[model samples]
Target: MASDHSLLAHLVPKLTRGVEDAVTDALAFILNESKPCRDALVDMVSVGDRRLASVANARTQVVASEGERLDLVAYDTAGSNRLIIESKFWAPLQDGQARRYVGHLADDGLAVLLFVAPEVRHETLWVKIARQFEHPSELKLGSTRQVGNMIVADVVNGDKRIALMGWDTLLAGLTNADSSMDANLQQLHCLALAQDEAAFAPLHAEDLNATVPRRLMAFNRLVDGVASRGAGEGWMTNKGLRAVPGRDGYLRFIGFCDTDGERLIELALYVSLKRWADLGTTPLWLRIWHKQAIDLVDLKHRLAEPGWLPAWSEPNWLWVPIELPLGVEYEDTLDSATAQVKRVRDIVVEMA
Candidate 1:
């Protein structure tokens, strides 16, 4: 588990993509500035190949001999770039990105192309990346562990190698090499750890067992029950129009109606995880765009009350919130969920 007070954890949402770029920069700095850290990384990556042994210094955002922009390059004593490290986070692999990076290393005669990413991707992401290497599709495709569960794939064409390493594997190597690493490296470790935690871990045996299905089935029952009540009130569901994304097992919020005025007024019970992840946020709310508010100042003033508060969104929107307290029992939570939705509905009714 990551620390509750990790600085990287806090800044991640605010910085958004800047954090990923900053992490790559921080890694390049640590590799160049700290010899112990750099040497340890090289030693770990080198393993049996011994080709990457000469890699001495690291640089960030180097353009390849080819036109592609490489993330990090590890240099050799002879000034030849022997290794390419691709830093990744929550982003899909670009078309031919892996193949192109490895191609850059292949030109060096002896090199390694390493991808450092969150550990959770071991099963999901690596397979997709592995497909990039196929020429009419390679017969042998899929990431494998050759260097202590770090190397994602081991491909040998003459004297070149392709490897995939988890952030955990790389950070552990740095720590194992020097227990008291530099402050920057320590911070990097914390940030990577926090990132993995936030990304959520791969499911284990407990998740695959019988206990989870019953709970999910019960939750589905709740959705069915609530949906039935909402349907009876003549709210348009638009269920067949479009499917919700990332919604788990009937977890999608019902699109109850179309319009309150010129635009639609979304008064529904939901957990807003919009990019910033309002996971533990208020359960009941009305989502209205800024344009929907004919007089923004007046609307803000009108919605200011004890049980309701209006919060603005970026680009253009406001969230009128009301807390929906829930309990473990299905009956109680069902009643609570229904009442909260009705309360939001009544508020919208008054506004109309």
Candidate 2:
């Protein structure tokens, strides 16, 4: 899967989700449904030194013994709460969140209060949470080391400890442990993949480059090419900041015909990922006005042919979405886009 693209994430994008809460819910679902998944998770934590029975259960939005609302809680076979988990994304820890969980540990229960966060936050989160076990608390920061690929921080109170792990590391371990995972695990993995891809990292010196703007300018040139082609085909072209709240800027084409006793119609091709027009399930498509003189039924069927993909909605206006080919070179892709746009326009002219 590409960055920011996941099966579950495609339906619910990362920007709209309460990332911390969503992670907690998805993981809890997988662990509760699959006992092997729970064992896999514990295997990563204990590094094969310990094992979690298949009967263990996982719950989310759990109220800890210390009255703190934890993101996840894992219960052993005997129904004892042995694993207290806190899921973090960008949100800071609540007031004394780590300290209270450490204080809640009895040191005799063999329980672990674990915090899972992004890899970028691994070192800093470990240090920040380790500070909570200082002075009066029975727990002490024992050691920080690499357990396989995970950067694990151990906060020791005799045998029991609080561990910090990265979400990426945890997901990787689980995947390696079980390759034939079910749909829940697969969906959870997709969500994690999207989160990892979307999470912005700390800025580096090499990021200050001109490549980003140069590519944006290339896209502008591509649109200009399409507009030029449309104007040459006897269609009026207009360029403007044509974007709705959820849509991107678009290039438009206007045509005048005597089909409906001399009328003018407009069509626009949006360059955004957002769904400004209803084109079935696809996020990629162009929008066209429904005020046309052509037969609606014939138009719908023809639009469903090889090149065009069209969908009907409750609205009075309909969009003609054309799928374009992505080429390596800028001019190649522009030519492909221009050809597709021309095909759609010609179809309309013939039908009208």
Candidate 3:
């Protein structure tokens, strides 16, 4: 027969204290590195602002309602432009107390909230926080977990909560970054060389194959030579590309490219760690220049219909035109899938 003593015995006060002490140690380690934590907070704000620029008071904390109290708030004071911050460090409290803090934050309309507990690692706290948000009638806590001991979160109503971690696949991405960069430029140069009548001639197959695996591998070597470094997430621009580490081994890249001859390109690449294992097709997304001039809906149907290898069958060759940045407007014209197809169509359209 089961005994009540068995369960109650394990819940001794001494054991509970020991666990509390351990969590305290973890929290202390995280908070001790002031610079990293601050940098992480800045990154979190930048991400939120970029994603949710429509909201008013973008980076400031609101006044708490009658029975609430908050820890930190990041918001914009005037229409999402200038940023404001508010933070508080409180001693570890009971579950009810934590819930109260979160509730206070919700009432105050804080765009971002940070709760720094010196007794528990932020990751452990986040799981509890996520559940809180699920029930708005109750309370929702927000935070993040990143490589090393960084934590941040989005508390704003419409803000995108980004989960950041150390992704090994990002290193794999480096393996081909530089080579792809150079080849893209070279292909742009080659196409320019083909002026007027030459442009009317068949596009070079070699130019189309420019940013293949070999070039990507060479680029990784170049990144390796420089040693891995982070420029912080806040550096992201509507035009520049940024690579961010993600949970497990996934890496997310964001940026735009514009080549000569007035063609604009914007691309987002998601490189999975698993891609390196078999070297299979790495998931990719591209936004290219002058997209509206093409027939995307027709192309999508043809692609799904199968046995439709009209021209460039090699996935590698399809990368050139889509990847290389040209100097023109291209967003409304094409999507990622259509851009890749256009790279091949550009050749066939000319050949025909």
lDDT (10s digit) by residue, model 2, range 4-65 = 33567666563565766787888887777666667887776664354433338878887766
TM-score of 2: 0.63
CA-lDDT, candidates in order:
0.62, 0.62, 0.33
Model 2 regions lying over 4 Å from their true place: 1-19, 48-55, 119-127, 130-138, 161-181, 187-202, 205-210, 239-267, 273-337, 343-352
| TM-score between candidate 3 and the true structure | 0.24
Per residue, candidate 3 scores C-alpha lDDT tens digits across 1-352 of 1111122222332356333233223222332323333333444344433532222222122345663433223333343322222221122334554444443332332333334332222344456555555665443334543533335455445343323221122112222333433332233222222111111223457757957655554333322221121112221123344455453232333322122222232323333333322222333322223243434344333444343322111222222222222343333222333444344434323332
Cα displacement (Å) at residue 122, model 1: 1.2
By lDDT: ranked, best first: 1, 2, 3
Q: TM-scores, in order shown?
A: 0.55, 0.63, 0.24
What's the residue-level lDDT of 166 in candidate 1? 86
lDDT for model 2 = 0.62
Residue 55 of candidate 1: its Cα lDDT? 59
lDDT of 1 by residue, 17-41 (tens): 5666667777887777667877787
**CA lDDT, candidate 3, residue 342:** 44
